[model samples]
Target: MTNRGRRIGRVGGGLPGIDRLFAALLARIDRGLAAGSIEVTLPGGGQRRLGGRAPGPGAVVDLRSWRALYRLATGGSAGWYEAWAAGEWASPDPVALFELFVANRHSLGDTARARFWSRLGRRLAHLARRNNPQKARENIAYHYDLGNDFYATWLDASMTYSSAMFEPGDTLEMGQAAKLAAILKRTNTQPAERILEIGCGWGSFAMLASGRGRRVHGVTLSAEQKRHVDAMALPGVDVTLTDYRALDGRYDAVVSIEMVEAVGREYWPAYLATIARVLKPGGRAAIQFIAFDPALFEAYARNVDFIQTYVFPGGLLIHEPEFRTIAERHGLRWEERYGFGPDYAETLRQWRERFDAADAEGRLPVDLDDGFRDLWRYYLMYCEGGFRGGGIDVVQVTLVKEG
Candidate 1:
């Protein structure tokens, strides 16, 4: 093991005594897992099985050291990731492990969540990265500004970043095109109508809508995405580096794809107000959003997860009931909601395959190193598992402004 691995293994200090504590922690986790199972290989060549009461996805995990449990007990998902990065544990299929955990989250309760001090520290850190105007730009840039070339290597030609609406026998590109068409249809706008796209990613929707003779305007915080969109220069399509709150001018219809998740729970009202404010009376807004199960939202919100920690700093999954209530408060009627969690799982799977291919074929950007690739891979797997377990979902909804 490397020096870092050795250090992680020594996290709780005293070896023989710590082993008993870690074993007790494992016992608690085993009792909580009502569905699915994990076969854990212990550090001292012993094997233990957890959660076989009900049949579900099964996983095999090799605990290389007791520190892996310590990290999981205190750090929650983020600490588990640290242990993985430091070689404290290994899994033949990490996705299954993640799926199992998410599937049994209710039964597990706080078994795998961050402890008091860790939760407080992470919550404070997340608060510091709140999505105010200035901080919002920084947060968006943190993820979306990772070079357009890097995303291009793995994303479909449309360059759409949100969940794709998949059909039978559809490729990723076909699914993405279908998603764009569905969102556009929800707008119910006629040709020559003006359309506004919030968080426009690479101008995919703008290009698609403008091709049909509609004037489309896109707003984004990522300079890289804006540059890419501007370079396209599709006729009737215009893009600017603008925050959603700063957007002005009324449009016939509005569309925001999976952008609300980054707004944070505190800013949800502001996001809906923007949508309601910009849409012409009787205009419809099509929004694609990812939401967490209501049962898990409180726990998820209390502590930062792996995605919030490493990928998107201030990100929060929507609590559907609360968000819908906010939309109603803004005089926006939320209607025609459609959810396809399995499709998102498939989408992530395809993206991971493409990313792996890009890495293997030397198509990824030269600046990205091994650690980044690993992190990206884990992100994809984690999201895929979350969707597969049905704890997280992707949905498209139409909100009609009160006329």
Candidate 2:
């Protein structure tokens, strides 16, 4: 029999009442492991044999604390009964632990989740101390400056690092190209017209626009991407390693793809105003982004920590209505909007494949491989589930400056 089944056998047969209790515990573990690996470690009260490795004393303690809190949150251990009976794992407070597990939505399989929680808790703790501008800059340089080549491995050719779902029966490349083309079409680009691209990653859109005989200027905070863009020097493309707030020129069209999220909640109005200032009156701008379900954010604050700390530092996602209101308040009128729910799932899957391919080819930093893989897997899968659950959505809004 399989290890899991063997474990299950220990508890399945009718036995003396005392023996039945032991069997029941094993049964729970079996059930928990049956669907997949049990990511969360068991509570301190349960058998330690099934518990995964604790990084150190702190992780174990934190988990134990969380377990207690979780049990209280979940109204007791009733939820874990089936798992205890299945012989996979056991927890004294199953309900609370399960509640916390699903709520975070970061854990993928068994091993990954445990490692993530441990590492994530550490990062959050680090953020609590020494989290001034210097540290923020250092963190950004470490993560975002991984080179355009590195990001290009997983990101779309345009390096639009937001949610993109594949339209029905569309490949990653096809859907992405369609999405980009859709953005260009919405902005009504014309030859010889000037366009500004905020947060340009590898300058793909700028290069493409230049190729089409339009003047395209792009801005980004990443010096790494700036170097790559400068090296390419495709005609009609101008790339700047600069901040959006520093931009001064007015353009016929402006596009900010997956960038606004970096504007923290307090800066939303100001950020929109800045965009309005640089956009010519009557000119259209495409603002494409991933937005959180506002209701979800209202429900919890810490739930967004993963995106803020790991993916985009100081980022805040808003609901479409809030975003539109902010833009309208800045004297911009929304012209068109589109949402791609499935496209992002397909995009993330492609990113995973490419990242894996690069890893297998020994192209990535050895020290970063495990973490990147774990991070990407969690990112991709959670996004897929989010899309599946409609917990999140992507939006492409075409806004024109009021005349």
Candidate 3:
């Protein structure tokens, strides 16, 4: 194994008789700093370490220098803080540093770069058992509960906040609408038929389907989303703040958009089972989800925490194949599969454009600078890259409950 790999494996594992690996790692970093091969010096003072454990004084960093240290500490085979002390890639604006990071995201290592992420996954799994509902609610609140007004400034009239479906040979708007229509078609909507939506965001699909004369029951983990959706509810729709597993009855069709990732791998089986349980035999349900390319699992696992910290908590981009396999395991058959990879790219572009234009208009909120803006920009552009590079895919999967 490579030295980086060995270090990661050792740290990830029990660390063989508790040999004080952190100390050894720290010593190695100290040595590297002394040898000058690792580089350690702070220039300007616009930066400080995130965790309290980072070094101090004379250890200050300029923006450019700090970024280089972050890259080295997080990317290389060793020295988390030592590398930051080097401060080689500093920039004047924090956003520039992030843009550089976003542009070169693929340069990060699989295990070492996302060391904080792996721990989070394990912690989530553990917490899921004890206070699943609270954790679920918090996760939802952290992401979707931000505020409807903020979302409204960019989303479609239907308030569909998930990835839009863009198809080849179609304009962005046409493709997105077509994607939604395609999912509706996949659900085989029948007038007056009962439908269930898991993790419903702002009730766009429910509203659309209800307009088609269907009775839609939408459940969401986010109370804010539920409240917003409920406020817009009409005669044929009901919006509830609830978990997918807690829904009481079966329906003619089920649909979930961009909600599965929060369910986590540990709960995938149960999640699928719940869907199957609520779906009537011969009924059709469509799921549109965020998925990473299967080959990129290692990178995803490592980097997922970055997203959790800055983008979506308890969020994941599962592989379409894995979802398919899980569906098969649950006796659910795939009826049709269409990918919305590029559509997401267009959607992000749209959102970025809207945000930039709005911000330029001096109408944007103050809390949107520095980290928040960086987070949103990274959220959009990296997602675009994920789709464009085929590192990620948004899939609309139509399925039927086996007889």
For each candidate in turn, the TM-score is 0.95, 0.68, 0.73
Give one digit per residue, the lDDT tens place, for model 2 in 106-132: 222231111344445634654453224
- Cα lDDT of model 1 by residue, 1-403, tens digit: 5211222232335666775677568778888888888887778665677878889989999989778888999999999999999999999989999999889888888888899999899989999999999999999999999999999999998898888889999999999999999999999999999999999998889988988888999999999999999999899888888888887789999999999888999999888999999999999999999999998789889999888999999999999999999999999999999999999999999999999999999999999999999999999999999998888999999999997
Q: Which residue pairs clash in candidate 3?
A: 63-90, 63-91, 64-89, 64-90, 64-91, 65-87, 65-90, 166-343
Q: Compose the digit string of candidate 3's lDDT tens values, residues 1-403.
A: 4222232222213545433543343334443331111122233322122212223212222433333433443443222222323434333332322322232334322323524544455446535433266687787788787777767766666677777766566554565566667778888878999989887788777777888898989888777888887788477999878887787687999988888888876677778888888888888889888877676575555443445545666766686677789888887999777776767767877877777676677656665665565457556654564455455778888889999
Order by lDDT, highest first: 1, 3, 2
**TM-score of model number 2:** 0.68
Which regions of candidate 1 are displaced past 4 Å? 1-17
Model 1 residue 354 CA deviation (Å) reads 0.5
Best by lDDT: 1
TM-score, cand. 1 vs. native:
0.95
Task: Give the whole-model CA lDDT for all candidates, comma-separated.
Answer: 0.90, 0.59, 0.62
